[model samples]
Target: MTLMTFVYLIAGLILLVAGAEVLVRGAAKLAAQFGIPPLIIGLTVVAFGTSAPETAVSVQAALDGKGDLAIGNVVGSNIANVLFILGLTALIAPLIVSRQLIRLDVPIMIGASLLTMGLAWDGSLSKLDGAVLFGGILTYTAFLIVSSRKDKAAAEDDEFTKELGLDETPKPYGWVINAALVLGGLVLLVAGSNFLVEGAVNLARALGLSELVIGLTVVAIGTSLPELATSVMAAIRGERDIAVGNIVGSNIFNLLCVLGLASLVSPLPIQIAANALAFDFPVMIAVAVACLPIFFSGFRINRWEGLLFVVYYVAYTVYLVLFSTGKPVAEVFAAAMLGYVLPLTAVTLVVVAGRAWHKHGFTGDELKR
Candidate 1:
């Protein structure tokens, strides 16, 4: 890679960190001042804000005619969100689950993910597919607003008035500052994505790796930095709701908003790569479904569980790298993943879904928080 590219890549990482910090803090303050419930802010504003990088990058990639990058970025991001971000955060502190997420967010996330997979299964995400995804975002946001209002009414008077000192009320300069932050954040996101994409492409070419491989491995992990920062910060602040919500919500947004919007700009035709279909997409589904055990088992993710997640993620990365480089050892990894891991994951999903139904009786009590 050229020296300039390295500089741009480093600069992009710095900007991504700075932008996410400003955006999160600003959104928190604004939500507090507006009397918006913490749950709503965590679900919508914080979730969408942190996902801005993926959105920008994916759209740019599509426009540049590198549609695989756009698709791979979103798919890879969802995997990273669950395996990497959630895993690391849980290691720091076990996440406490809210009933709201268990009932509403997690299921919705799964549905969206499955929907995306189904849409792309036909070998492309057309403009119509994009519209459907974007429509889901609109519907989900509206539901949150309506639900928050009803929740506000049913909440105990003290509950509504309880101050979360972590979130500051907006100051007179809040709009000005926030607008600047949002704008700056967008700029950095765009720049960082460009540099990262370019550098990644160059490195892949030099190493004789396919773009799809690079997208699934390096690009995916790199763009997931925002989720890592946001979730880790939320965990540090003891904001378990934000920590868990950020990952789940970002995954949803990455699939719907980011890929949805990107596909609208340019249809993403599937390349029929065996790794993507047989391995990567299935892994995405598996990692997403893996959440059920953690979320439903005890409504929390303990430190040991967190370590397990990290290990799974590391193993996943190693397998991908080895497979890409044509290593003989990859056959063992592939066989293990497909022959054992995939079926095990499927069984887990079925069992978890059944338990969720038995516990909640199809009425979704998990949503009652």
Candidate 2:
């Protein structure tokens, strides 16, 4: 409500972005120096680093017994990552979906989304549930590393390595510098999270909104800025792989790492609000499911599809705002989306998927072009 509140929000966002950038750069360089493959670094370290803000914020909220904020941040972030970040990125330049994403990563993302929902079905995420989610991420990462080794070996020229300056010979004390960067980044992230959470909690109180709603909207979007920047820049630079892969990878981490770690660290189970279980979870699952058909259609997200995605995200956010404010229009808007828009989208996606599959059998890579 006050200027200081806005200052906290802005300052927190700036620090989170700066911290993530430093952490990812340092970690990527360090991984490369240690002979880790560029692809693995991109999939694991960079993705995790970009999601560090969510991890920090959620864990802090959970420790403070703000369970809704913790849960909302993770679920909302995954939604925003796909609907908002990817949507905006694709609009900037049509994103080419790699076969690997459609065939493997997207499915994993969907599975993860479902698994999270099932775990939260009981209304809270226990430490055991957290462990299960955390274990899944470990298994998934190991699988990716092992399976991608051949591809990594065959990569005579890795653009990611070159982009990270990993192609250069290591200098003396390089690891030391990288380590400092990682540490400094962590410090900034911790400090920024405290500020952001405090600001968000205060803002929620001032606006007569729940912390969950603030987490779902403001905190979620603020923390996702790194992914937004990364994907949009990758799109412009023609590194379509990074642009698409980054979003998918980050969603996975947000679920498996951010939420898992938060729940594990909390003194009590992180409770899932009834509203979240009834609405947000379903919406997140639908968004994840939607990715498959969109990616399958020509193995690319066209500009119009991007526009559709952006429009849907706006509609979704507006609905949440209206619903939270107890506006009468919320019901009418929800009715329209349910009765008309959603079914139309479902039919459109099915048609597109069918045509693409018929054009080039599912096994064929012709759509990659």
Q: Who wins the lDDT comparison?
A: 2
Residue pairs that clash (backbone atoms under 3 angstroms), model 1: none
Model 1 residue 234 CA deviation (Å) reads: 2.6
| Runs with alpha carbons beyond 4 Å of true place in candidate 1 | 21-43, 152-178, 267-274, 340-369
Question: Residues 308-364, candidate 2, lDDT per residue (tens digit)?
Answer: 999999999999989998999999999999999999999999999889888877677
The regions of model 2 sitting more than 4 angstroms off are 35-37, 154-157, 367-369
Residue 314, candidate 1: how far off, in angstroms?
Answer: 1.4
User: Residue by residue across 99-181, what tens digits does model 1's lDDT show?
Assistant: 77877788888888788878878777788988999998888887876777676644422332342233344568776776776
Model 1, C-alpha of 54: deviation from truth (Å): 0.7
TM-score for each of the candidates = 0.82, 0.96
